[model samples]
Target: MTARKKGPPTGGSGANAGAPDTLEGLFPRFPGTKDIRYHPVFQGGLSRWVWRYYTHRLTRAGRWFLGLTCLLGLVGSTSLEIQTYIPFLYAFAFWTVAGAAAAFSRPRVAFVARHADRVCAGETLPVEIEIEQRGRLGGADLNVLPSGLPIPVDAIPEGGVPVPPLRRGEKARVRLGLLCRRRGVYVLRGYRVETDFPLGLLNAYRVFGEERSLLVYPPFHRLARMEMPTGRRFHAGGVALASLLGDSFEFLGNREYREGDNVRDIDWRATARLDTPILREYREEFFLRVAVVLDTHVPRGGRRDEREARRAALERAISVCAGITDYIARQEYIVDLFAAGPNLYHLTAGRSLAYLDQILDILACVEENPDEPFAVIEPQIDERLAQINSVVCVFLDWDETRRAFVENLRRGGAGVKVVLVRDAPPTLDPSGDERAGAIPVIGRADFERGVEEL
Candidate 1:
C-alpha cells in the first residue's frame, strides 16, 4: 500500500494543488510510491570535490570564454609575449576568480517539495517546490531550476513565487510541469540547483534533493461505441433467464428466509401464504469471465538493438491489453488478465472502483519477459476455459504454436478474438488460425477499427 499524497501544498509550494481531475478518476496511483530514495552526495576526496564543485557543464558561450582564458594564460607564461597581452591575462583572471567565488558558495536556502508523479501517459503533472532559508535571496542570484532534467525549461514555476531576497530569512515556492512519454516506472534522482551569480560564464550547480518515483500507466481507449456482447450463462444461479445464459449479473430462484437476508427484499406474500418466513432466493451471480492473455515473450538470441525494438513492440501490446481490460471491465464483466512478467500473473480486474485502481497499478509496472515461453499460460487458460465466455488473445509473434492455442480456446466453446500486435507479421498461409479461417484476427494498429467491425 502507498501513502496517498495530499493536494499540492495550498500555500503554493507543491506540485498539482489537488488530485488529478481526469475522466471519472479512471487513473490509478502510479506504480511506485513506496520508500524515499537518496541522490548522490559528494564524498571528501580530491576527485569528488573537483568534479562536483570546480567543474560543470559549460554553456555554449561559457565554453568559448573558458577557452579564451586558457589561451591568455598560455601566452603570459612565455617571457617573449607582448606587454599589451599581459593586461588581457590579468583581466580574464579577475573575472574567473570573482565569478567562481560567488557561485561556489553553498546554497543558504533549504528546499522541500511535493510531486503528483503518478500520471497516465501523455498527461501533464504538477510539481511544487518550497524554499526556507535563514537569509534573503538576492535578486536572481539564487536561481532555482529543477536539476537533472534533460530540458530544464519545461518545469514552470507558480505565480508570485518570490525569488527571496539575499541576507534576509524568507520562504519561496516554485511549480513545475512533467510530461510522461511512456508506460512504466521512472525515478527522479533529484532537482539540480545551479547559480551563475557573478558571471553567466560558469553556472555552478549542486544536487539538493531526495529521489522521487513516477509511474505512468497505459492510456485507456474505448473499443467502440457499440455495446459488448454478454455471454450465455456458463454457471448456476440467477433469475436472468437471458443473462443467466452468460453475463455479469444473474437472478437466482428464491430460497428460505435467512437472518442476513435484507428485510426489505423479503417476499411478504410468500411469508403470509406459508405462515413462515420466506426470502427472495436469487442464484449466486458471477460475470462472464473475460480471459485476456497478453503474450510478452520476445524471441531470444537477438542483438541489444533488435531486442530493444522487440520490447517497444511488446509495450504496444501491453497498451492493447490495458485497452481491452478497460473495455471489458467497463461492460461490467470479471476481467481475468493472464500476463507474463518476472513470474506469470493472473489478475482479476473488476468494475468496482477499488479493484479498477488495483488492476491498473499492477499493469503499470509489468515488464516483458523473453525467457518465458508463451505456452506457460496455456494450461491456466484451459483450467478456466469452461467459465470464460470470451477470450481476447494479444501476442508478440505468430507461429503454428500460437495459432493452435487460439484454436484450442475456440474448440473449448469460448468466443475467440485475436489481436496480432505490431511485432508479428501476418500469416497469409491458409490454416485454422489464418485470417481466412473462422477466428477473427486483427492487427494491433487497427484494434479500434477491428473491434468496430466485430
Candidate 2:
C-alpha cells in the first residue's frame, strides 16, 4: 500500500498555495485535469461534437486498431489485395462507433476522500475513497486512474484501484495507502476517475474533484528520562538565578515576609531580633524556566555533498529541539524557544501539551536562513537568559564561535547546557570531561545517550 506523493514534493509552494500561516486553497492541477484551452473546436479545425468525441473517445485499443487498419490498407493498395484491406477497415469502423457511444455513456458517480485525522512525516495513512452512483447508473465497471498529488499516493495491489459494481445510489470504498514523505498541511486536489464500461476498447474518464487536506506534524521520538541542571545560586540585577525555594540548605538571605510567602520560611529567630516578620530566602528555587535556543542558519558556500550534509544536519537539529522541547515541557518547566531565520520563532510553553504542540507546529516549517547567523540572535538569547535560570542551546556547529557563546552564558549567571550537532561522531572522553563545562557534542546515533547523561 502506498499513497501518491503527498503533495508537490518538489517545493512547498504548490500552485495556489497560500501563506504559510494559513494553508488554504485548492491544490495544483496535473495533466489530465487541465481543461482544453484551445482544441480543434476553438480554432475551427473541427466541430465541437468531433472535438468532444476526440477528447475521451479514443482508447489505446481503439487507436491501435485504427493504426493497424491504415497499415493494412496501405499494404493492400501496394499489392492490390482487397481481402486484407476490407477486413481491417470493417474492424476499425466497428470500434469507431463503439468508442463514440462509450464517450457519451460515462458512468455517473460521486466520490469522497477520507483519511486519518492527523499524520506525521514517515507515517503511512490510508485514504479511503468512497465512490457512489449519482443517478440510476448501475453495475458499471470503471478503470479509475489516479494522478499523483505532491506526495506519493499508492493504490493497493497495484494496477488501478478497482471499484465494485454497486446498485443505484450505492457506494463502494477503495483504499489507497499514502505515505507522508514530509511535514506540512497538504491539500490533495483531485483524482481522475476513468471508466471504459461494457467494452475495454474506449476511453471515458471524468475529473472527480476531491479537495481534501491533511496535516503532518513534525516527527516525534520518545526519549529516556532526563534531568536538566538549574545553575548555581546567583542573585543580581532583576534576574533571579534558580527558583524562589530551591534547596533548603542553600539559603541566600532573610527578607521581610510578604503575602503568599511560605509559612515554613518564617524565621522566628530573625523575627524576634529584628522586631519584624523575616522570611528566609533561598537561591535556585523557582519555576524551572529553560531557554531553548536553536541554531537554524544553514552554513553556506561548500561542496554540493557538504551542503546537503549540512542541510540534513540542520533538520536533525530541529528534530532534536522538538524532542528536547517536549521533554523539558513534560517536566513542568517553562520552555522558551528562541530561533531566528526567515522568521524569529519564539514561544514560551508551559507544562501543557498544547504549548508543546505550538512549538512543534513552528518547528515543522522552520527552515534555515542563509542570511542570518547565530551572532544576529545572540543579543536576543542574552536578553532571554537574563530572565531565566537555565539556558539550553542547540547549535548547528561547534567552533570558537559557539565556545564563546557558552562562555558568555556562563558569565550571565544562568546555568548553561549546550548541545552541539555535527556530522562526525564526537571524539572526547565518554566521561564527558574532555570538553570542560556541560557542552555535549551529541552525535546523531547517540542523541538519546548524550542528552540523558547531560
Candidate 3:
C-alpha cells in the first residue's frame, strides 16, 4: 500500500483561489477508485449498499429493464398521456416479476475447488470445482464464477463456466480460468453459483465459503549473460549445508589412522599394504556467494501520474532482480537476496540449497516503501559481509543515499556492481569518479524490447 502524506491540504492556484469547496474538489481525478472503495464512509452504510446492489444483485438484463422503466415513467409523467403510461406499466410489471423469481431462485449446493498453490502473474490459473446438488429439486443452467479475486471483474471471461444439468443428489465438475494481472498473495473465498434460468433477466447466486490461498510470482525476462566482480568464500559445511551426507566432502589423501578417527573413514586396502590403519583426509569447500540488494523505496507526495511512473520503475527493478537471481543460480553460486519494503526480506538460496522459486516468492510480495529502505538493508548486509563474495545492487534511482550505500560496501572489501532501473536514460553519471566503474541503467523501452544481457 502507498503511504499517504500527513498534513493539511494545499490550496489551489490564484485562478481558482475563490472556488467553492465541493465533493469534486475533495476527490481529485485518479486512474482507479481504490482509495474511494476503501474509504471509511464508503465501506458501510448507504453508499456501500448501493454499490453492492448495482454490481452483485442486479444482472445486465435487469439493469436494462430498470433503466427503460425509469425513462418511460419520466416521459409519461411529463406528457400526461395514457398511451405513454402503457409502456411504462408494462416495463414495471416485467421488472417486478423478474425480481420475485430471483428472490426465490437461490440454489442449494456445495462446492469443492482444486487449483495449484502458486502461479506466475499474467498467466491464467485453471480451477476445477466439484458442485454437488443438495436440494430435492434438480438444477439446470448453473453458472460457476470465482469470487474475491484481487483483479477486476473484466479479467474473467464474459460468461462464467457453464455447469451441466444435475439431478437430485447428483454432482458435476466445472473448470474456470482466472487471469491474474499482478503479483501478490490472494485468498480465494469460494465460488458463486448462479442462474438466469427462466427469464434471463435477474441473477440469483449462492456464495460458498471454501477459502484457499495462492501465491503469484512476478514474471521476468531470461538473461543470456551477466557479468559481475566476484570471488570465492569458504563454506564450512559445503554441500553438507544442503544435504547431510553423500559427495559433500572432497578427497585429499590418505593418512595414518588416528585413535579418534571414525571407522567409516578407514582405508582398508592402504591399511593392509602398509600394515597400519589409514584414514581419508578431506578439505572444506569454497564457492562464490553473491548478494542481490533490491531498492523498494519510492518517495511519496507526487501527482498521480508521477506516482504511477515510479511504481512502474519499481516493478522493472523487481524483474531485473529476478533475472539476476536466475543467472546466478545457473552459475552454481550461492545467492543471498535482501529487500526492504514494509518489512525486511532476506533469503539465501542457490548452490543446490534452494531453488529460484523461493526468491521469486519474495519479489512477488514486496511492496513500495515510502521510507528509506537502505537503512533497513545496510545492517543486514553488514552482518553477513564477511561471507558475501560480491554485492549487486538494483536501484530505482541513483541518489546519494544509494550511492553511499554501494560505496560503503565496496570500501568494506566486497566486490560491488550497480544496476539502475529508470524510465529514461540518465543525463549524467551519479558517480563522478570513472575509476569506480560505470553503472548500467536499464530503461523502460529496453525492458519492452527485451533485456538479453546485463
Candidate 4:
C-alpha cells in the first residue's frame, strides 16, 4: 500500500490578483470543492538557505538601484529638498520587495506515485504519478527527471499533457519508462519529480512516497534444439487408439450410462429403441515424461570471479531452463525441472505454459548457497524417477561426478543426455579419456551451433 500526500488546494487563475503571499498563508481558509493535503519536503537545509540568500541579494540589488536613482534626483532637484525624495525612495523599495517576493513565492506542490517493484526480467511496465497543486500557484510546470536505470527505458511519463497549467483544485499525471535487464531483486532509487515554472531560477522537487523495489527474473532462453526421445502424443480428452491394442497402460471397457451419457458419445439409435444409454470405452495411454536438471553448484566457470561470474552463471541457467521449458512444452511433453544448489527447487510435471512460467520465476530467484552436496541431493531426485522417462541435464561443464550420475541413470533404463554449457573449463580433470558417446558437449561460443546440433 502507498501513502497519500496532501498539497495546497488552490492554484493561480492567471497571475497577481489571487496569488498567495507565502506558502504558509496560502492554506485554504475554507476547504475548497477539492481537498488538498500538504506534504512538505524541504530541499537540503544548506541549499534552501543559499537560495533564500540569493533571492534576498537580488531584492537588495533592486533596492540599491532605486536608491541610487533617487539620490541622483535628490541631488539634482533645486526647489525640493533631499527629504522629499525619501517618500519616493520608500515607494521604490516597496515595489522592489514585492517583485522579489512574487518571484520567490513558489506554489506548494505534492506528487503522489505508485510503482510495481518487481516484474519478470526482460518485461516492461509503467510507473504512474499524480500531482496536485497546493496554493494559488502563479504558474508551474511538472516533470519527472530522468535518472540511472537498470532496465531499458520504455515509455516514461505514461502520457500526460506535455505541459499542463496547474490550477487550483486541479491535478496532473505523469509516467516513466522501465526495462528489466536481468534476474535479481533491485532497489529503485533517485526517482524524483521536479517543477521549474514561473521562475526558472529555482527547481522545486519532491520525492514520491511510493518507495518500492523490483524483483526481476532472469530471461528464459529458448531451447528449441534440445534432444528429446520421441514418445506418444495425445489430443485433449482423446485416447490413442494404437496404444490400446495390448500395449496401453490402462484397460477400460464399454459400459451402459446410468443417467448422463455424453450426447455425442451416446449410441442414439440403440437408445431410441431400447431407451438405454451406451458409450464407447477409452483406453488411455500415458506419454513419456522428461525431467530438466540444472546444476546450480559453484562450478569452475562460476568461480571465475567471486560474485559477478556466479551471478552470470545462475542467470544463464535460468535462461536455459526457460528455453528448455518452452521447447519441451511445444513438443507436448510433460516437462519437469529440478535445481540443486544452496537449496533445491522441484517443479512437477506439467505441459502448461503457465506452469513453465512459474518454473522460470523460481529459476530467477535461484542463487548459489554453500549447502548440501550434489551427490546428497541426487537421492532426492532419484525418488521421482519412476514418472520421468528421459532426463536433459544442463550444467556448466562435464566432470567425473556428472558423468557417473549420467551413467547411473542410463544403466537404470532412463534415456539421458547431458547439455554441458562450456563457458569455461571444468575444475576436475578426466581420468580415463573416453571419447564422447551419445551426449553432446557444447561451448558458449558455439551456442548457435549447439542449438542446431541438439
> Best TM-score goes to which candidate?
3
Error of 4 at 265 (Å): 5.3
- Positional deviation of residue 425's Cα in model 1 after best superposition, in angstroms: 3.4
- Residue 200 miss distance in model 2 (angstroms): 2.3
RMSD of each: 9.9, 9.9, 7.2, 14.2
Counting clashing residue pairs in each candidate, in order, gives 29, 26, 0, 20
Candidate No. with top lDDT: 3
- Candidate 1 residue-wise lDDT, 1-454, digit = tens: 2212332221111111122233321212111111111112223366443443333434345667767877876776675546646766676886668576655554666778788767776676777877666534443455555544321112444111335455445667776666655665555556655555556666655567576766667666656542333366545542223332243334566667878878876888988999988777555555576778888776678687767667766766776677778777777676778876645667765545235556666566666675655667888888878878888877676677777887788888787776666634544333353431443344545654444433
| TM values, all candidates | 0.70, 0.66, 0.83, 0.61
lDDT of candidate model 4 versus the reference: 0.53
Worst 10 residues of 4 by lDDT: 30-39
Q: Backbone clash tally for model 1? A: 29
Query: lDDT scores for all predictions?
Result: 0.58, 0.62, 0.74, 0.53
Give the TM-score comparing model 2 with the true structure, all chains together.
0.66
Ranking of all candidate structures by their lDDT, best first: 3, 2, 1, 4
Off by over 4 Å in 4: 1-124, 128-135, 145-163, 187-191, 197-202, 211-213, 230-254, 258-265, 273-275, 299-311, 370-373, 427-437, 447-453
Estimate the overall C-alpha local distance difference test score of candidate 1. 0.58
**How do the residues 250-349 of candidate 3 rate in per-residue lDDT, one tens digit apiece?**
7899999888889998999999999999998987667788999999887789787877788888888888999999999887787889988876789888
How do the residues 276-343 of candidate 4 rate in per-residue lDDT, one tens digit apiece?
77665566566666778887766343343654454455456556666777687676566667776545
Model 1: CA > 4 A from native: 1-61, 103-105, 136-139, 148-169, 204-206, 225-230, 233-264, 267-278, 301-309, 353-357, 427-454
Better of 1 and 2 by TM-score: 1
